[model samples]
Target: MSKSTSLLAAVALVVTGGVALADDTKVGILMDITGPIASFIPPLQNAANLAVNQANEQGGLLDGKAIAVFGDTTGSAQGAVDAAGKLVNIENVPIIMGSLMSGTTIAAAEAVAIPAGVVQISPTATSPAITDIEDNDLMYRIVPSDNYQGEVLAKMVLEAGNKEVAVTYVNNDYGVGIGQTFIEAYKAAGGKITSAVKHEEKKDSYRSELATLSQAGGSALVVIAYAGDSGGKIVKQSIEGGLFTNFIGTDGLRDEALINDIGAEALATSFFSSPTSPADNPNQGTLHELYNAAYGEGADKAFVDQTYDATFLTLLAIQKAGSTDRAAMAAALRSVASAPGEKVGPGEWAKARKLLMDGKDIDYDGAGGSYDFDKNGDVSGYIGKFVVDGNSYKQTEVMQ
Candidate 1:
């Protein structure tokens, strides 16, 4: 029932949602489209576009068609507040999918989204700090927090047989949260860290920091930073300066740009970690089919699944609310996510709408996996170990 049901439901939704859409409704997109983590946003933005397009084809929300109006966060907190302010006050969107980075997501939630009562869902912000934000249930994220990813990452590093390593993290919520967690987990797991150093992003050079980290001569270096900013530069400088050869990083460094910038030969012995779906998740294959048909084969990329799921859930919540009312939409978010009525997944938009119209509840299972949101609006998921193979990095292991 899992695979076949998902496939048939997907095909039906695709066919129904492919027709010309009529009315127009807007959903906000807050991202780092061209900032520090810029490389990650393209596929994510495409995913958002794909989901909204599919929704419109499925007859949109209520009598209005869904649209993704974007605002760049510049990959910073203040940038997020500015972008979110425009989205809430000007665009007046009921829901926003954005602030891919953790700091920006927090900023948007506290300073803009929550106060405005606009629901915000992040596709990639995974800091542990997000677990206790007082958003009054207005903020949500599709990815598991670093609280989960960090421990899983630590386990991966230890299991890889690297007992002693040096650590460097960018100075931000994403880095600090994951770094501390990895440190504690690594130490507890009988691994020894040379020293934990903090690095700032957008720096032209990290040679000094790399020198300090590799002072004691370590077998591996763990870096938790954005690829476009300090992480890629650090890896490149480390290799050229002969400070360190083997390197590791988190999702922030898991990008094609990193490999291109630093070259594959340098990262051949290194690895990075990021969140991924469970092997048994029933939605991924169908999502690939829909993605390939719309954007061409191989168009699907990182965060595409979560981006699609988050976008779908956002619009569905507004549909469930039956209005653009912010509070009502926020209240409906969990109902659309968890179970109680008809089971829904990607390409099941029409089915879901019918169920809702019939006064039945619906559970939205999507590309990433089944989302059973905890009280904090977080979910349990898997993390993958990515290693460089020739010119790009690919998932080598996925751990829950």
Candidate 2:
């Protein structure tokens, strides 16, 4: 694990509210904690630990406490495989929650989780490619696929008067899935793309790509990349080179790091699209209250609600299964998460446990959304339109 990831994990474990037992049940946590999305991991790690700590405080997992064993997918494919191998083969966790990036999630699933017969749930792996994985119901994600977000973003861009734009995306599963989908939808909706470039991540500069993209004039630049990696660099270089003023970004680019790196004033005219919870769901308010009380801040961080919900639901699935039997997880998860049962919201582990003990069903309407998973283990969800709000971003509208 990287130094930052190790520090965050230590912080989460140290500040967690409960004491862990020797007979605790270990659950695997896979995340891109090192390379690109490092800035987004601390709050998400806190959310995961919150779920585990909440379960421990509320009478634990199957037979004892729930312990989170993390695996840092150094933001690469082989790194994901190695980390997942350690979780499944070494720690022997029955289930895993994580791998927020689409690339790492897919790689870990295809290479490790499926072969090991371990069920994995993701909070923010939004690639359209994940919808078609032949996992036999072992893989699940709480967020809507990038296919949905891509269509919504196309409409958002067009409606925002960006008739012409230059598109650039990182060359990875995350960027390719949303970038191509948005390109097709944008063109179909009569929007014009003056130029589009697929760039690699971790480069020191995007000046060459910006120069190429600037050769064709456009209204704004549509960047589909992580803010900590290629996206922030592209936006900064674009502004520095006077290539484009207005910018449009997807979820990967919608990090607080972006606003911090590129001043809020420069990004005032920029907008972003990301998976957001249903506005009408009161569970979100409950989660926010509990989260703020626990951590004192960061209740509104990207994917914090979804991460906590995923971890909590994973624990609930273990409880519903009554054992850590790998094959039984899928049915147990569906039974506890879908309808035809008593509704359970965030921070209600004890209630959910009692309901399961009494032979009752549960519908886990999470802080993110009601995760009534469809045939592909994908849920229909909301996408939010956001603009820079001081040091962070704020949702101005919810797009279904």
Q: Which candidate is the best by lDDT?
A: 2
How close is every model to the real structure, measured as TM-score? 0.92, 0.96
Indicate the TM-score of model 2: 0.96
Q: What lDDT tens digits, residue by residue, belong to model 1 across residues 1-400?
A: 2352233222211111333344566788777765787777656766777887877677666786776777777777887898889889887888888678999999989999998888898888999889899888887998999988888888888888899999999889999999999999999998999978988878898888888888966689999998888888888899888888889899899888888888888788888888887777778888878888876744446788888888888888888888888879766888999888678888778888777767789999888888888888888988888888776667777788
Top candidate by TM-score? 2
Q: Where does the lowest 10-residue lDDT sum fall in candidate 2? A: 9-18
Please report how far candidate 2 places residue 40 from its true position, in Å.
0.6
lDDT of 1: 0.81
